[model samples]
Target: MKINGFRGRLITADHADYDTARAVWNGAVDRRPRLIARCGGSADVAAAVRFARDHDLEIAVRGGGHNVAGTAVCEDGIVIDLSAMRAVRVDPAGRTARVQGGALWGDVDHTTQAHALATTGGIVSHTGVAGLTLGGGIGFLMRAHGLTVDNLLAAEVVTAEGDVVRASADEHPDLFWALRGGGGNFGVVSSFRFALHPVGPTVLAGPIFWAADDTTEVLRFYRDFAAEAPDELGTVVRLGTVPPLPAIPAELHWRPAVAVICCYAGAVDDGERAVRALRRFGTPLVDLLAPTRYAAFQAATDDTVLHGWHYYWKSTNLAGLSDDTIAVITDHAYAARSPRSYSAMFHMGGAVARVPQDATAYAGREVAHNIIIDGVWLPAESGKHAAAETAWARRFLQALQPHRATGVYVNFLDSDDDTGRVREAYGDRTYRRLAEVKAKYDPDNAFHHNKNIGPG
Candidate 1:
């Protein structure tokens, strides 16, 4: 098949950079695309989409390519690579930002921080703003400012049929609603306009850890503490084996611990008072909570979750953290085979829930918490430890099934099928609406690499 009219870098399998072009964040995915089009701008994106449609080729869209499931690449197909378009324009006067789809969270954060403004973004600095925001973005500022989608003002997208269009509250209203939380199933988002808020140049943030044996006490306090915690305080409870890293005290290396990672996005004086009870909760092994730059705090965990590591993630929303659920979670926390594996519970309420459930496609606004079981292991010879690490994560998820809520965060979903998991993520009503929108925008399911809602 011959193709032309592309004004971007069109790399075939024989290209020298083909191998690197096909690589994504998850080393577990090793698919090779037949062609990759490195888009330079929105017009390039539209041209690629048109060429793919003309050839009847399956399409994969790559932004920052940080998806844990590695849906950014596909086998024997065309990939619209957007990584080269990482431009960010901040409008301090309007308190908003115009971000290219390929720009990472760090790009948006750093640019907006210069203006003392920010929007909710992923904790990982390198995560793509497009993917995370489309899947209902969660981050340190979630409680204070709501999910990233909540701040989205507009988007420039290339539809499956190769039309460049804008989506917002007034234009393409249904498409706008679906874009808020519907993965990349509708089109390739070329640029995003986000409403920014006065977050911080500095905020009191960091983790407070306690010995693993104190899990029960710590969890009980966390459960109650978060129940009435102010919206400015966003917290996450993590159960994992401490890595032997320089940031950690050498003596506590490789020890088991339960920690509350805090991000207080309010006044320094108010943040200190808000987190005082948490700091004084039990004899914490270490308290690293202090005023720090928000962008710095967002990138603090970059070393641990770097690219090239094999990753499998499972998650479920919970009505709230219960005593029984905590017991089950802590029981499996100790059984993780990899030091990088962990079980995390994110406090989900405040601004996220204040928005009505049907306000957007993002379901589970009423959910009180979300548990993510992350299984990560360093690359091993012959992939010997892959089975063991994955099994541990699955078992941990199975144990929590009884306490699982009806909905799950679309961003945290790992499966790529139209199964019950996908249905549960959006619920029946929202799922139906998503299917209608999917049919309208991408009738042939050209963008089905994500947790897809079919064009029924």
Candidate 2:
């Protein structure tokens, strides 16, 4: 159990914190690893990679451990837990942030916002920067600043063979290309340097909710509004119940409703003008949109999708939000079995679509929206409720199959999703290209724990 030169906390089965070490963010995942290496930095990560390879143990790289698939901790394998390595250094003069792979979106935002600089990050502040970026991150800033992957300037990685290297446009360029959207199939990224832009200390943003019965009309309006909205106007449509919070009317607590979560990264005056039509939309149960601190709003709704929840998700890249597609989504939302379960549609386009289709490993540039059918519940309702939850997510996906775009986001893939689904995440050509890069960097497929692009 001794890992030579591994200068980090190594937790074994007998370790006092073994149970805690193996636990990831998803309550549905109950994996027991033979070794949990709490990496201190790149050297520790390299040592763990070498140890895992020498022992023929599967390697699960854990950043934020928020991956719904629970691939962050493998049963009877080695987990390269990077949670302790969170360190963010901002270069305000250069407009860049060099962050450790373990850092969460909140860490990056906290540091970068001090200098009034930011980059695209996942909706939840607790989500890992590495996993989200590697799989083509979609977030509030995406419409204006592009995806997190698009902002990724460089990465420091530990290869499958235990070699430390840097990947960027000028060094290990091929590996850098794959790192953008190729997931974790190639290497374990120890750190990332991202291109940052002037964001805000505060921006106009929040949620507006309507009764579930008005979802149809809301969808139609959103489809048109989103299509024409300026790049600064980013939006997310959610069909779910209102959380029982004081900000909302007490009577509306836990009531089925549809919401438009809006963030405008522009002048407050212009943003006011931009969202005026939406503010006037059919009788809303509540309208909370207002000028808010950017970093604060990023985690505002985290309570709804908290850690340790029993999470199962099925997602797709939609070709467009046509009337038929909206109908299918509304039907599933109404028929959803669990009150905790809901459907979400993320608006895609603007800076994300402007990127060339073949520019990075991410190939969903033309997709107008990314939809997810999320099945969530508490552990107390876990055992028998799994079947119904699983069925609902699967059936929801099947209903949207015909309207799906060319590729699904790899980050959204579930733990049991098959290799065919992985291929679908990347088109045949991009997947093949990624495999070539995989073969060059990780010929043995040591990092197959992710949405893998197997080495050819």
Candidate 3:
């Protein structure tokens, strides 16, 4: 199963670094690929794809290798590694940027910040731009701008047939729409061009924390505040333990806390005034909000969580958080096993909701809040934490039954979750259209590592 002339590094199981190469972000996933192709460029990617198809080998495409499910590495087949192609090109005048498949959000941020601009990106800097955008990215700028996919202008993809082609609104438009939020089901995206917005050379943004006992008051206040927040301001409320840090008081370390992390993308004075209302409403344990560089704000939590930690995350869309829903969240908030585990709800309606549902593959725009339950634990405690997290999330979902959206966020899906639920994430018509597109572009279903819809 070797292509002697292919211009890339082909590593077999016998390779010296095969064990190291096969590892992914989450230590929970352990897959061993028979062969790994360290793709150098589009040509190398195409060759690897063809070789895998010819040999009937399962195929996996790894960008930054950050997928929580480890879809980036196959169990017994070929992996097309794109880590070498981390180039980013920013066009300041055009307010756009072209990012390579393997580039992380940090790469995009660094490149765009040089121009005092940014695209919609994930909250975490280490998350790969490719997967996040492909899965309908939600982040600080989402309310102000839109999903990361909404900012996407074009993509260079290597399809199932080993063809390198461009997808945009005017060219291969169906493929373009699917690529926007369809995950990696149709092809491997080699590069993406995205429209950028002015975020900040310096902006008002940071985390404001309150004690766990204040969760109810803080959440209720946040619900109202976020509902009326100006489009320029985006906030995510997280319930978790305060990390043991020098900045945090010793008495509060490891204690439960409610945090409202705010980002204001408008004028400094306007941001100050808007955030002031939040600061004054609660008796905060820590108020870290102030004027800061957008980059600094983006990277603030970068050190808290590292790769290889066991992570179980589930996400759902809510029309609005009702009283029952808040109670469910509050009950589970106190039962979290790992101090690092948390539940977060992001206000998702603004410029994002204004976009028509039929405009792209992303169909959850009508949802008001994006809720995620993250269970982060050490390797030894994974089994113990998994069941509780699952139960808590299930109970919470049931409580919000009437408010839940039919669609789900593909990025936050768990492995054992129901496949039927994927369709629910896209609604009926959009799911049907996505299936058709899957048939047209990926008839063989070679790219099915994500929240997949089989070829029609």
> Model-by-model lDDT, in order?
0.88, 0.91, 0.84
Model 3, position 453, has a per-residue lDDT of 87
Local error of candidate 3 at 5, Å? 5.2
Where does the lowest 10-residue lDDT sum fall in candidate 1? 411-420
All candidates' TM-scores? 0.97, 0.98, 0.96
lDDT of 1 by residue, 55-173 (tens): 88889899999888788898898999999989999999999899999999999989999988899999889999989999999888899899999999999999998899999999998
Worst 10 residues of 3 by lDDT: 392-401
For model 1, what is the error of residue 269's alpha carbon versus the real structure, in angstroms, after optimal superposition?
Answer: 1.0
- Tens-digit lDDT track for model 3 on 102-148? 89999999889988899888888888888899989989999889999
> What ordering of candidates by lDDT runs from best to worst?
2, 1, 3
Candidate that beats the other on lDDT, 1 or 3, i.e. the better one: 1
- Among the numbered candidates, top TM-score falls to 2
Q: Give residue 29's lDDT in candidate 2 (0 to 100).
A: 98
